[model samples]
Target: MTPDEFTATYREHYPRLVNLARRIVGDQATAEDVAQDAFVALLKATLHDEQTVPRFLSVAVKNRSRDVLRHRKVAHKYAPFETFGPLSAEYALSVALFIDIIAALRTLPASQRRAIVLRTYAGLSEAEIADRMGWARGTVKSHTARARASLRRELAEVA
Candidate 1:
């Protein structure tokens, strides 16, 4: 599709797509990200028909939402705080804190978010992240450092 057509399509359907994802994912920011990802997929697609674009985007959003739900389930299953044994006060507090940390992570810039997730969640080293992300080691270090500072500030505010 033409740029103008794509812009119009994005403007027309973005909000509805986000709302649909939000209903599935139960998070506004995540829904927005999911919708944006769908748009990116639409751009990458070869389809050019106006009538097919919206349907394509809708399916993309739903698929991404399902992926997010699956990831959430896996994360919850392996959450470090789950080692607390039972639903005690400490377990509840830990779960709440983990949720807050995730929200804070979402508020970070894309580069910072990627760096932090690779380092913290995936247990990758700075060199490994740099290699995987196709960046210099210094760049990875900077992104992770900035991400850490931002997360500290965000989590502090939550506390």
Candidate 2:
């Protein structure tokens, strides 16, 4: 594709691709980075068909998200002990609570987790989440509602 075509494609698809990556990776900043990287990779390649651009970008974003998740897993394995250094009692308690919430999020089923993350962290509306996840709008709402209830119960028990 030419530079203009590439620019147009990027503008059209960037937001949706970033949302897709965010669903996979669950972090907005990292998702943006992943989407940008995919576009950069597309620019570097020679492609004869503009029609394939969206599919190519979607696959690229998924691969990059997987790479990021793998790297995070490896990093967590060797994370430094001082990462959570001495803190005030209130600060420590808050940190513990945050950790607990993350753990609770992980325990949810994959659909529930993705729905909750997309809705809460990415701030996507139900219709947007439905489009990204290829689910009906009502399905997204149901998943999010169930996930929220489960989290509430789990956190309440912990408290």
Candidate 3:
């Protein structure tokens, strides 16, 4: 599709995506930022089809929410790497999953989580995320891969 079409899609879907992001990210400002960034990426995309729009949006929102969570965790100095041990395995797994998601997210150098969230949650095309992030598509793909791998490894160790 043409640039105009992309813009129109962004306009139509941005509010919905923002609402979704707000639910996960838990604030208005960060939600707006995530929505804006996602739509900006969508605006820059070559929308060869429209059927995948929902998927694209979901990924973007999820990715952005995760970013906000990571930022909040770091800004608050709530690092889980510090030993707070002696919890049981089940409780430990639950807590670790929560912390693991946060720690894995913090481990990302920003770009990786962007790619990971977009791909895994928002279901965005790598090309679209790359276009939005202004990186090569392959870079988007690898960042996603690494992010997933890291999360799995980190969570498993805690488990």
Model 1 alpha-carbon drift over 4 Å, by segment: 82-159
Over 1-159, each residue of candidate 1 has an lDDT whose tens digit, in order, gives 789988999999999999999999999999999999999999899995668988999999999999999999998888897563579788789989999999999999999999999999999999999999999999999999999999999999999
- lDDT scores for all predictions? 0.94, 0.94, 0.81
lDDT of 3 by residue, 55-158 (tens): 88788779878988998878668657544556688986787577768787787878887888888778889888999889998888788888889888877786
Alpha-carbon shift of residue 113 in model 3 (angstroms): 54
> Per-residue lDDT of 107-146 in model 2, one digit per residue for the tens?
8999999999999999999999999999999999899999
Cα TM-score of candidate 3: 0.44
Clashes of each: 0, 0, 3
Q: If scored against the real structure, what TM-score would every candidate get?
A: 0.52, 0.53, 0.44
Clash count, candidate 1: 0
lDDT of 1 at 132: 98
